[model samples]
Target: GAGVSQSPSNKVTEKGKDVELRCDPISGHTALYWYRQSLGQGLEFLIYFQGNSAPDKSGLPSDRFSAERTGGSVSTLTIQRTQQEDSAVYLCASSPQPGTGNYEQYFGPGTRLTVT
Candidate 1:
């Protein structure tokens, strides 16, 4: 893919509803990350994936938030029992490697999600 791509750029749903956000990272990139951005706030790390190993999901706000990377290319972020507080821009990013000095991550446009 050309950079990172997120589907359904904008989403609106009821408070109890669930949503699945998709991300396709840049081809050949070995590291993927997910973040949440509140209005006028900086991005907060949610999860990170390196190759096919287990993902780092320590940043997930609650058990309702989860993510998984499939085949080291595409990833899905699932928010269950969505709450109004969950409204925010979901961002996806990728880098060639993880923890290498000077590594830069390219971010996706982001998916704006709203819970009514």
Candidate 2:
């Protein structure tokens, strides 16, 4: 599939540990986003990147959560000092453009992170 992809499909870490998640978007996509989904909950937006624009990180739950897109293609999400409440599935999505009439996001299967 020529869509978004995520790495380390599953991760288990102890509290206070640091973890990094990876995402690779489709070629040429200019808009990338990161989200978090808790069990039985809807996806919560985490961050957004569009072209060379400043990334929108307002959705990050805390200073511990951060992300960056490099070369406008690959992205990495980092969680510092993991907490039990941080256990969730991290999802990545990308779109060719933002808010176009036909604009839609393609989502990756997601990376599941569990903190113990």
Best TM-score goes to which candidate?
2
lDDT of 1 at 96: 90
TM-scores across all candidates? 0.94, 0.96
Residue 86 CA displacement from its true place in model 2, Å: 0.4
Looking at model 2, residue 42 earns an lDDT score of 99
Model 1 lDDT on a 0 to 1 scale: 0.94
Tens-place lDDT per residue, model 1, 1-116, is 37789988999999999999999999989999999999989999999999988889899999999998888899999999999999999999999966667489999999999999
**Residue 59 deviation, candidate 2, in Å?**
0.5
Q: What Cα-based lDDT does every candidate model obtain?
A: 0.94, 0.95
lDDT of 2 by residue, 1-116 (tens): 58789999999999999999999998988999999999999999999999999999999999999898899899999999999999999999999876676588999999999999
Cα misplacement distance, residue 63 of candidate 1 (Å): 0.3
For model 1, what is the error of residue 16's alpha carbon versus the real structure, in angstroms, after optimal superposition? 0.4
lDDT of 1 at 66: 93
